[model samples]
Target: MVADFDTIDININVGPQHPSTHGVFRMVLTVDGELVRDLDAVVGYLHRGAEKLLENQDYRQGIGIQDRTEYLAQFPAEQSYVMAAEKLGGFVVPERAEYVRVICVELNRIASHFMFMGAYGTDVGVFGTSFIYGFRERERVYRFFEELTGERMMYSYFRVGGLAWEVMDGFEEKARALLQELKRGINDINGLLTRNEIFIARTRHVGEISAERAIEYGLSGPVLRSTGVRWDVRKDEPYSVYDRFDFDVPVGEFGDCYDRYMVRLEEMRQAVRIVEQALDQMPKSGPIMPEKMPRMLRLPAGEVYVPVESARGEYGVYLVSRGGNHPWRCRVKSPCFTNLQALREMTVGEYVADSVVILGSIDLVLSEVDR
Candidate 1:
């Protein structure tokens, strides 16, 4: 016989389809009154086993598959895989190609952050404000991407050695104009959300985590920065011509939902700055792909790990080559997987409704987590 507590118990299923869960994620919540006593995130409803699938496909073909893993941050996924292959294969990317990759990845970061902001706002009951603002800014970035890669979402633009496509004529000018408008829109969004008293009250002290705890949980990007750690893979690791750019890694004093939200908001501004600098300093001419780029890329027998500062955080890809076109083994270290581990720690003792806000603040993609 089990001893039952005097307090009432209630069980709630958050979702396999909840808007706040974000992409086929479900959570089983055990609550007493409004307080969440125990929480379990049930994932794998979206698992496609991308790593296993990649082992059977050619290197070029695998890039397209990686795009679907984290659909919102497709550029970084592709970038991480491509960089891994390049390192393993000893391919040298031209200066122009590196600059182009930087611009694309940073722009994608803004788009990903926009999606997070919109979803997070809805989670907190600020219905339409974040949605309108986020997608409004996202449209400009998508337009630029559509023009360059001809695909808005699943862009397999990044290849093993360089890029699949080159920058089109007048692309620089269009990118500049789009980024300028985006900067203004970011300011307007900050004024609308960050300064609002209600927004602050809802998130300021909620889902609080210390810098020590964040590091212990292997947190990165805005989540870690929100705890006042100024670590960024782009700056610290310096891959794909990021070292040439001048930008600040924004940090927050409090590690709360609001702090994470604000840190990402500021990160968009920094991304815009880096994009502008990349556009100005980009080389005039070079081969987008290597001169001897093979149609079937076969790497020497070895392993390499590449990490990129994705919109989410440190997105890493580890590849093992067996002197063949297909990788012997491939692994993706998705940030969402590690970040989601911190959820129960953040959510316990908070209200059930606040769990949604907490999840939104973490900004996990179920595909990435389950992969």
Candidate 2:
């Protein structure tokens, strides 16, 4: 029994402007009726020569560039960039500074995931309710960030050897209170979408990728974890003070859109745990920066690469020094760009509408992809 029709495949260009494309991204989709036969993703429309630009900026000034490169999770970007310099210079970060860095970055991870849940809710057709719920909690974190760092979004708070300055007064009280609030917020978001039949129908088993394929594409963060891969850089490749924290790395079995959503939801809870521990273990009083630091930082001739587990995935910085205040070459390893590579593999053979779901699940920041 064969039923064949002479249907012509039509090409549709989605974005560089389309709202669902997530950023200034363009993808040419070859469609046969409602099915996606092929997808050609077009990036670089938002490119700003971030790496080349980093070469021109000094170590201190470059924190701002890292903020923009992964704006959604600026702390990780700033952390990676600064740690590279610290490594090359053999600088020691005080214990208090390490704990503070962990706390702030973990909170940033929660905020970034909240942003994803908000936007991904819209993509899954839950629209305003999830968007509002997600942002409500995100705003709370942002307000705290503004108070501590003096900048809401791109807080270049991290410096070469340590923090630019010690944290604000009542840092522990505020951070612990914020963690409690985030716990309740995570529960709220969970209740909103976790059991919703429509949400599950839309996301469950849609855009499925096998664990092996996910690793093959160099996927990381929630995307790779969703595929049942126990490969979190925080746990497997202990950076910062992550080795001291005991938080579970969430993974999913099906490796579908639903798994991605669930992984991020659970990750938020784990972030809260890490923050609480960091607050408890942090030194009561200490210097944020090391003593006897030179006015100008000039590293010996060498190269070093430092990677941190960002909200997205592995945010790494490769620094090449020639004994100067500025690096000879600065390279950023962006997880979004690498994760986006699997979009075509995930989209082809799925419904055209599911393409939006697939891309949304990636939770990419255009700046990271274009950086």
Candidate 3:
């Protein structure tokens, strides 16, 4: 005979839908009343076989695939891909081009974080106000990018030796103007939710993870930094001209959803700091692409891995060449995919309602996760 009070845990499904799950992500949750006992994250719904596609494309052609793979943070993906080719080919990027690359990538980081703030606010139930605040600044940044690359999103502007072409006229002036607008946007988001009691109560201590646990889970970007790990690829690894600029890597003490939010909030300020420095240091005139460039690019037989600090985390690309126009093998170390591994850990033991908040804290781009 069974005890009268005994009850079995119930399974609840969240997403595979656009709005509820953030991007075609589905999680099966085991719940006992309002508390979650366990979770199983379902991915690969948005997989587009980016690695397989890269094999058939030449170094330059593969840039588009990189853009699609990490759609939200396209420049870093493009940078990693091109850097890998540059590594194998031994092409020297111009000083001016390097500075420009730094400026563009940093601005993209801010825009990507703005995206997080908007979506995160909605996940936390702040609704349209937060979303509007985020997109308002983000769209401004996008318009600036569109003016430069002629495409708001899928910008394959970064090339193997340098950029596809020189930046448009008055690039510096427009970027400076955009930075001032972004500062106000960041402040708006901070005012809207940072001190709000409802926001704090919902996020402060919920989904807490230890630094050790985070490292063990292989988390990176904001998710890892939230747990008080003060590591950033731009700072620690110091790729490109990042070593020339000065900026602090933000970290959190509690490793909760709130800490993750704060870390990204501070990062926007740091990004603006880096861009201002780059503008002052950039060369006035120089070749964007290396001279003596062959009409066709064929990397020597070798293997190389280049990692760049994307908005999400370390976006690394491993490329192998067999002395050909096309790469023999291409693999991406997407931070989103690695970070998603720990979602179950963060979600379990929290309230069922908090699952959405926890998942949003990871700030996932499912295409990257599924790539």
lDDT of each: 0.89, 0.92, 0.92
Regions of candidate 1 where Cα sits further than 4 Å from its true position = 1-5
| Prediction 1 TM-score vs. true | 0.97
Mind giving the per-residue lDDT tens digits that candidate 3 earns over 114-203? 999999999999988899999999999999999999999999899989999889999999999999999999999999989988889889
Instruction: Look at candidate 2 and tell me the lDDT of residue 312.
Output: 92
Q: Tens digit of lDDT per residue, candidate 2, span 66-132?
A: 9999989999999999999999998999888899899889999999999999999999999899999
How does each model score on TM-score? 0.97, 0.98, 0.98
Model 2 pairs whose backbones collide: none
For model 3, the local distance difference test gives 0.92
Q: Of the candidates numbered 1 and 2, which has the greater TM-score value?
A: 2
The ten-residue window of minimal lDDT in model 1 covers: 1-10
Q: Which stretches of candidate 2 lie over 4 Å from their true place?
A: 1-3
Worst 10 residues of 3 by lDDT: 1-10
Backbone clashes for every candidate come to 0, 0, 0
Q: How well does candidate 1 score on lDDT at residue 97? A: 93
